[model samples]
Target: MIKNNNIDNIGGMEFATFRLKEGVTETRLVELSHQVEAEFLSQQEELILHFLVRGTDGVYADVAIASSQEKAEEYCQQWLRNKVALEYLELLDKESVNMTFWSKIN
Candidate 1:
């Protein structure tokens, strides 16, 4: 779930953290991430870069950079409802989910 939804005037970045669900492998997550990129993220006009990262503690992070804060917020809200996005989300431990958006500063 989203932890903060604060908006800023500049472009922003999305930092979403979660743990993989039981039986979910990193390979599978990576494969599905590609699908989400193709079908969902790539469609966003202001999206700059979207990538997945894993921590030593097993927590995973989904990082997305957008050209504008408004577009970032818009994409985040819309992605939650996208079928491909939902499929990717299913790999994560639901209770571990936390998303925060950070706006770029001068």
Candidate 2:
């Protein structure tokens, strides 16, 4: 059975945070985001993603996957295989280190 959406200590959540590059219009960005969420991310039940883009500040996402860091990395790679999806965001740091964090609902 599928587990609840809320994150807990038992299910260690890994985060994949990224940012949007300049010149992508808000309308295009949102459209691409919805498509990615529904078509790509939703297909993977092992993943839970939170795409955050408020105003014009920046584009960020907190991706919580139900498995190891390697799986999380694989998921990220798969999500980017879409050409349209690739235009929406970029890694905040090309040299950033990957880390795992716990997620939970208050």
Question: For model 1, what is the C-alpha lDDT against the true structure?
Answer: 0.82
Q: lDDT of each model, Cα atoms only?
A: 0.82, 0.53
Candidate 2 runs further than 4 Å off: 1-19, 53-64, 90-106
Residues 54-95, model 1: lDDT tens digits? 998899999887876667778989977999889888999999
Give the clashing pairs for model 2: none
| Candidate 2 local Cα displacement, residue 69, angstroms | 2.6
- On residues 40-95, what C-alpha lDDT tens digit does candidate 2 reach at each position? 66666666444543433453554545544555666667755866556554423334
- Of candidate 2, the 10-residue stretch with the lowest lDDT total is 90-99
State the lDDT at 27 in candidate 2: 67
> Candidate 2 versus the native: TM-score?
0.55
